[model samples]
Target chain A: MNPRKNGILCLLLVLMCGVLVLSGCGGGGAATPPATPPAGGSDEPAAGEPINVGLNLELTGSSAEFGLSGQNGMKLAFDKVNAEGGVLDGRMFNYIPADNKSEAGEATSATTRLVGENVVAILGPMTTAAVLGSIQLVTDNNIVLITPSGTNARLTVNEDGTLNPWIFRACFIDPFQGEVAANFAMDVLGAETAAIAYDIVGDYSGGLAASFKQTFEAAGKTVVREEQFSAGDTDFRPIIENIKTAGPDVIFVPAYYTDDGRFVLQARDAEVTVPILGGDGWGSGDMVGIAGAENMNNTFYVDFVYMDDPSLQDFVSEYQAAYNRAPDGFSVLGYESAMMLVEAVKNAGGTDPEALRSALENLGEFTGISGTMTFDPETHNPAKTAVILESVDGVKEFKQIVEPK
Target chain B: MRWTKYLIWLAAAGAFYALTLALSGAGFISRFMLMTMVQICIYIIMALGLNLITGFTGQLSIGHAGFMSIGAYAAGFLASTYGGRVSAALTEALGGAGGAAVYYIFILATLAAGAFVAAAFGVLLGLPTLRLRGDYLAIATIGFGEIVRIVLLNTKALGASSGLPVKNSVGWTTAYWLMLLSVVLIYNFVNSSHGRACISIRENEIAAETMGINTTKYKVMAFALGAGLAGLAGGIYANHMYLIHPNSFNFLKSFEILVMVVLGGLGSITGCILGAVVMTVMNNALSAFPEMRMIVISVLLVVMMIFRPNGLMGTTELRLPFRRKAAGGKEDVTHGL
Candidate 1:
């Protein structure tokens, strides 16, 4: 250890100081201007009155795509509202976005920063686990937290069925998708037995699969075979072989589109053809590219709304016109949630936390591009129409819309 | 000479604590800043623990996060199940819950509980796995970390993947003091006779063994001490975030901590501290630059490794303020007993 090299290292220390100082500017502010700069006379401009809605999305981690989509949707909603002369006496809904990095702890920290910003409500954290991790902080802060697409059944409801006041979601819970899929398979597809091959590593898939199985079995139909595969698994031969052996009337592969490609390809390769069912996570065009249109035939999944649905054309075009891309379930939900928040703020007449929460709870019926949503004030879950879109030669076609009983 | 140096270190640390307290008191520091500062302290303690084994003792225990997970769960269980009861009881003795005394007692108790549990497991793990060296040791530690993660993931009591959420009685003051205390204890141990035995083994195990040093015993001791420190860090972490997920302490986490030790210069306390602070702050700060964050971090790490293979501080410590005079070919006051 030459002491002379210490001199160079000390210079590096000074260099590190520069890094720290630069980065400090980025993360420096406590809460991005705490609660509207006091409204201190001097003719506050329109920008000064913008409502700070916190967006705690998974912008740069494993679930970056979904978070980005959600962000885009919210941004569109904000932009549209702002362009139309803003909300609540020309107050633009200014959003402060925080990337949670798709980690739970980061989500909590991000939520804290958002709360400190004194946002009337937080729009998202995209995924279920991130939402769960962030929930406590928002609850403690008494800010309404409306996730765009967090569908885990237990998110808003505890095991004992107690409801968390601050948490709400624009998307229907997992049970709705499971029930919709079960009823669709049982009543429409006329299946006596179903096979489920779910992504074991994902938080959404397992719970969704469980609910589907529960609803299917409770309706006096058996889940013939249940196979597990992790998210990154490429081979579906072993599981597909087992599913083929079981020979259930329908096969449920409840997973993200990322996992859908390999499984669908391999299952088709094995020539084990049955209607493959999934949840909203399967609503992506990548499925066609990977598994081929022929392989994706007879496949259906439950989603909030199909992009090709005539009623959704306005939203689809708006999203495409705004971002140059078609809208997915995440973006749709993000758009709906942001719009709903704007409505709530309008209904409450101000951003008073309690008033806003009550307005959100009693939002009753919200008709957005996604569909008509009637929020259950008790559970904070939405009762909305779940659409089953069938893949016909790599293109999704309208199958049927299942109304919540 | 050493006594005066340590006292100076203490004074410097005290001043730092006071300065931060004043800053936050004057509302100069944001809650987010305070949170980041606390996180740096926790990571520093963790890095120091890893530094003891992998750096000083030359044992590559990559699964340092395993001990941390164990410690966190243990602390989480205590705080969630009995935190209120204990706090209330202690509050009855020391006036009320409004005071800081009860919180200190409660947090220290949880930290100690976590440390003992992790240390006991460390002794259990090190007894058999210490025989393996280098990569083999790393592999074994990785397995241990994975196993702990899986166990926690499946445990219904801990909320599995969703994670166990608990309110914490800890704040910046508790975190800062705990870190300073850990660094001082480690410094004292490093300058002690047992520390030399461990260092001797690290330098040359065969020679140290031939010189009547109980190499295995010293190695195991270093491991337990290191693990205990990791547990302490974990306990603070759980309190800091108010949630503990097994996935957060996975294999990648172990690799990150190892990167800190190596990037900080293995076997150098100040190096580990520097590494820990830089790594943690960099992670948070990089988030501010969304798009270029990871790219910048990766490029910087590559550049650092290419130019400064020995790391920022290398084997030499940054002598703060009053420098100690080197004399008699030795820096430590302890003369082999």
Candidate 2:
């Protein structure tokens, strides 16, 4: 063959291979229309076409664990609804999951692809950075986006409290979690003074730490020391020593499990055990593995849901049986978000985005694994109870539930 | 024969533009594909700029994304704050033709502003760093990139880490034409006398200086021009994406653009365009399978490098069979470099 022809052939072969691979991976399993008629004849709404929903999550990056668990939880909820004859009187819910890979650009592209698929609603791109990256697209298209774990207060509402009509989340915002932790530290633990060690570069950590400090101080508690560290910091001994010097009754580390675990280990190794406190960022199982069982004992963090809660026992057991591990805060929130969206779709009686959005806006007091959820009309954030969990012998033991004011 | 060639080129350009307009308007192309096309256009502009500096001029700048970020933020801020009023006023004053005319004018102004500001930064960064060689210059540029990111991250007016959301000012049609214009302009520049001087500097800096090339001025000029083009890309990107974040223009992004320039073939305009399109398509295509996307892309890069070390074009231009040669012997000067 001529060299030019060979080159063209090679290019064509590669192009064909790429298209095959993309098409193979892009097919989200088709949803079959219901064949059977409703058993409850009279009041049953007519069975319609299946509803297409999109799930955008971080499946293979630093936040993969959260994304995977969220996927499992969402799938479980979806399966459960399908088994119960589906929502909208038999219109099955079909979820198309895309991996954001925990990058902002990826999040935008993934969400855009999902939008292209004509989904009625999008479930999650779990982290705050990913959520913010895709929020503009969602808002511009007027698509309903219900993130499972994005907790930045500025997400659903602007800083000045103007509502973003298209955005909502299942998990409580950072300020709420921060306030709950502060209240728990001051009232329950009887802590007079507190110190904070936060990751300055992280939106979640910085925002949570600030809210905690502000609330703690407003309640007549002294925040003795505030130390900062960016992500990828290896040494926390110096910061721990500084906190020890200030001698606060409690120390708040508003960071993810990776950093929190190292801080816990380094703090304990230094023998500076003043009851450590944090937010939902410390809910990952990696925390126990990183900080050892002994080091993790007595550490407390506020979270959206606890797997051990009696109300969530069925889900917890089912999740363990399926994934062979106990579900974490992210999983529970994911399950709740999916369930909430399903309920909204059922209530709205259609898959239209505007109808589903209004249904969500007026979602009053719905009971789930994560307490009662009622989205505030002004800000699309749900008002729900946050549970304080203490690490006892490497186990997440539910301590107390703080109800919203 | 020359007129026939020109007519063919014009017809091809017209057909391409019409296709883009039809696809975008008819909703035949998915939003995902449209977004990907916009990204490809932006990356092509950016890679072309980088190719001019690193490929043609032998200046290794690892921080081109820094200039892009500056342009993105500058344009994003302007569009967010004042674009609506200006566009609205133009639409009112111009009557029927005003809307499109205003859109073109506004987009062009923002892109030009972004390019100018980025060029200014380029001059600021290039003046001192152009004195240094290779690794030192790379480090200096990287530091400049980091400085831009840090400044944007801290500056509340630029939305800090939360990011600034610009109005969706430009569509795929506008972006497509702008990118094509940039490619043509850069192609023409690469064939100019100044371009030959830049290439000579790349071949041997000391020799070029001895040959009265004024190496420093050419180097700085190439750097500034490259940065200005990058800024133009950033402006379109911000307006198209409707949002800009400091994190979007970090080291990883710069590395990605570098990969395109290297993968396409150094000192090759056609190569840069090819590389940009292929990479952008591959990225979008493989995104669905997140687990193996990175691995697949890395393996492909490795294979391509092994097969064609100099890249797909290897400093060679792809010429049409019907085109006549240039009047002078100017083409010979570009071959050795």
Candidate 3:
């Protein structure tokens, strides 16, 4: 063999050795022995490096608006906490956001990667299904997930009616919001009969609609013409025509902004003259322009909390100054979630996820933008009040807050 | 020479099996690595089967995932419903054989069932659409995918939209090893005379027919076999993940499989393995940069296609990195034991 060729081969071998060395050294972090607590009762930043805090929020795609809102609120909360000299005595928090693509599969892959990175905790994916994926992946590695917007009833419920210990949500779920809408319908509108139209594919929409029906029936009003449609179904004329024949005083359309806006317009065009009611999903400003003011008159909905209160007036102003728009229910949920996560970390006295999880479970009197919340020991869902909103000229004007009975 | 090749292959297989055993019971990182390797092995099986038709035999199937979904749900349902009964029957038949025997038979039956069903679906899909051009075939398959998803999501008998859960780990481990072995068997099969005929059809249909190759029959057979292997992967995945949701096997999954085959180089076995491993690693690495991951992946893919479209290894198996001395001066494959 030529010496030059031999040298080249030797060089390649060295390069391969270097690569192997790097990979081995890199993976050594996983095998480190567990950290032992300090002997003394002193609480400091462990004398060396500050622990890295991970924030995995959906930062782009179909739910980009919600993700951006979550980003802003979390940034604000972190800024405020760092200003007051950080949690665990100046262990600074760092944020690392990932896009969930508004898809569960993407969320699973993202959570898996975060596990590999060995982050202490994750913040938001905004949607219930996305949160569900993160919960299973993160909890296996003892990583805490604090989500703000996922309000599905099943997030806290197992098949055998037990609570999932690893997952916790800041926002009140669908059943509470549904009952809020139900009470508002009975007390405010004095309606006798209601028609229902909901999306079949969306678990949230279906769950909320069912809760609303249960509450409405419990309140002594009959529900007529329960019809279902899928997400992105453009035609709602048949459903409207069916509802029109039933002649209900009010109709409940539990859906997101995109379909809710179109449903309102189509229902009006088909001469279905009835007041429309929805849940927090209908709190977007885009709905106002999509449905038009004329079509949205006398529409009532339930949401996290109303932003029109005097205490929340400054937040609304600040949000408008920052993003140039009135803060919606989603924005409020994001803010509350960030606040709740911070509170849990502070209460735990350290960034340890297990300690923080217990702190979250025992969380009491944490005053948030939405309402004061306390997670019931049995279920990780926050026990709080739901605020009702009435759409006047297509804008969600505050009505009243309903306390859960 | 062929015996030597077989010996080398057997040694490699033994080494890999040993590696899996060493990694499986290791700490967290090693466990994760092995799990990922198992996933890659399953994906390779699916991609290789797809390659048989789309690469060698020339048939288009955009809805390969639809057949996979069927296989997954079927496995999940069977495992949950009649698992105990089947185990008992197998135990009764093979009196003192114990749990291992039951596990072996159950997994074999599941794979066979999956292949049979997937092949049936392929034939059903192929009979009408064989005469159609490429794009039309793509559209037909896409429609089939959507239809299957809708049906699976709504069918209450198959657990409806809630999804079917898989709970057996032994079944999954068995399936993974099965897939790895099947991949090797497929590599050998594709290098055989039948595969030569299939490739001839791919190179030129009319010429292959003039050479007495039954183009239609071979194409259908290739598609059916590809679909069968995809189904097998689906069955393994269903049992391993412990949840077989209809949504898991959609058009997006088919696209990912396509990306693997394309990146691996269409006709190369080693290339397929390299592609699958690299893509999975890239996927994990880019988790931190989710917003920019797609951009990076897309750029890499485009650059690769633009430059080395033949892929890292083109139409070749992983050979000894040595050259043999020919009639010329000493080549690189020299000085063997």
Candidate 4:
């Protein structure tokens, strides 16, 4: 190409990109009025304005299964609330979801963008590491954030032992889930020794593994083996071989369904027929599908609620009807997140951020698919029961329940 | 004539900064929008750095993001641990604006230290892969980047996979100035005799060697300089985002920087700037439409590659009225864009 043509092409490239950026940024807040300034009085919105709820989720990368399910659940709750004449003086909640692309940096960017959209409160970013990335942003913005599935204990509590004030989660913290898994393995499975393999790279997995080790050892049990695997490692046969040789009565793999599913399959393939226990990371519907039900006979994991519970049957059906798919643990947590946040908004009587925050800080019992739970006033994590489910005939059957003190 | 060029650049920078402030003041640029601007500047610095190594020089270093990760972690550690004390000390000594300026200067120094470390690694990487060429060199660089990422992933003090928080007080203006400096320095470097040697190597390494250019020395120099620039960008980026993760500087990020260098034209400084801006803008713009964003971007890249295989600028520099005439005021045939 000639120099003139190249110049023209470069100019065209710049023009095209420039126009796109303008169009992208300019498509903001034209249809709805700006966030109402906090004016002490609780009054109706003049134009039926929306209570914009921002969602920063991992919708398109690793652990996307969690984010997409959580987003869908939140959408269903919003649709139901909108159908019921809305909340906070009949103002519908306009849910704005921003995909974090399953990266910590992208999570921060997504949260920053969502916070700029005049959202009343932000929810989600399903994984713990992604939640950690966005916590500082929400703290800086003085906006409330409720992650649907992120259960890292440090998210709501800082290293200095102070409450983060703005960050909360619908699910219980990792330690609690860890304790439940440990208790089930010890009491239900009658295991004296456990072998553990965890994802070293995941905040959720690492924290959960540590918590399980502590809880199990505190209960006078032995941890025979401890193996570490990074997030995307597919070779679990070596780790499984080590765990088998360690002669532990049960194996605890507190990793995500993506990694743990293959580990279970490999362990079974190696003829290590001991019971395998796991944390909430294995609570996805896709988990059993990965390990295959025949190989998952003695495999069990802690979850927020059971899908086939009589109490959650309505939510399960409603979710399936809405999305044409079964609800996972993240979906249930996300539904409860929306339900609790909307209830708080209604109680606060306005979309004022401070009022909404205080209302969320004092959220009462929210009985939904995730079982009855109320946010702890100190830590902002819900005090809820964790259920253990076993793979039974190609389905997750409720095996046991571990209630929080 | 030199003063005119310098004056024009300063004026342009001032105008751009003022426009940003004006736009933000008028509510056109939100916090997120300004954040995007900072990111764009950061990426421009990085892309320009890669352009120097792979574009101006014949060395195709694919481990640019590895250098970036090193700089980011170094800056992150410094800012989070000592940034407060250093800023306080500077402010105590200078007070107010002077103190703030000095604090920013201290941040730049930390960034420079990061660049130094990254350059040291670049030289180390270069020594081992000196004889390798083309795809073999690319594979080696890719392995180097992966090793850096994996190390960062496993380092507990650096927050492991949880990511490190950078508590530096830097912002868009810092990024803009740093990027401007990078572009100016790289532009000057590309015009020097050393740059001509590098370009000759790009054309024909054997011919360049026959012409008495120390191929080994120049190759290592190119890697060091390019890595240092990327390190500078990484420091600013970590400060801007306030968090840095190993995943942020993965192989995909390296490939993205390489794409910017290739798409902007293999040997054009001005083209790299354009490429960075376009790519970052396209990413942000398409965020408003998530479903079709990937499809659109892939289509654009494929079309651009097919239509302009030499790239958007094709070895041409952006023609400016204030730019000094090439050498003895005769019309230059090399650059006409």
The top-ranked prediction according to DockQ is 4
Docking class of 3: acceptable
When candidate 3 is compared with the true two-chain complex, its DockQ is 0.26
Model 4 score (lDDT): 0.83
lDDT-best of 1 and 3: 1
Worst 10 residues of 2 chain A by lDDT: A28-37
Interface RMSD of each: 2.4, 2.4, 6.0, 1.7
Where is model 2 more than 4 Å wrong at Cα?
Answer: A1-48, B1-8, B85-100, B324-337
Query: What's the TM for model 2?
Result: 0.91
Which residue pairs does candidate 3 place in steric collision? B166-B242, B322-B333, B323-B332, B323-B333, B324-B333
Q: Which lDDT tens digits does candidate 3 get at residues B1-337?
A: 6577568767877787766666565643443354456667678888888778776666666887887887777666777677767777767776756765766678668766876787788777777776675778788888988899889877877755456645544333565577767776667667667777878887888899999998777777777778778878777776665456677678988877777777766776665666676666655445555666688678878876775575545454444454233213632111221
Q: How accurate locally, in lDDT, is each candidate?
A: 0.83, 0.84, 0.71, 0.83
Give the per-residue lDDT of model 3 (tens digit) for A112-218: 55565556677787876567656656666787777878887777677689877877777888878777777777778888898889887657788888888998998
Candidate 3 residue-wise lDDT at A113? 50
Cand. 1 TM to true fold: 0.92
Q: Which 10 consecutive positions of candidate 4 chain B have the poorest summed lDDT?
A: B328-337
* Error in Å for residue A390 of model 4: 0.7
Q: Write model 1 residue lDDT over A219-254, tens digit each, in one string.
A: 999998999987778878999999999999999988
Evaluated against the true chain A, what TM-score does chain A of model 4 have?
0.93
Better of 3 and 4 by TM-score: 4
Q: Candidates 2 and 4: which is better by DockQ? A: 4
Q: How well is each residue in B247-303 modelled by candidate 2, as lDDT tens digits?
A: 889888899999999877889887788789878888887776777789988997898
Arrange candidates by TM-score, highest first: which order?
Answer: 4, 1, 2, 3
Best-fitting candidate, measured by TM-score? 4
TM-score attained by model 4: 0.95
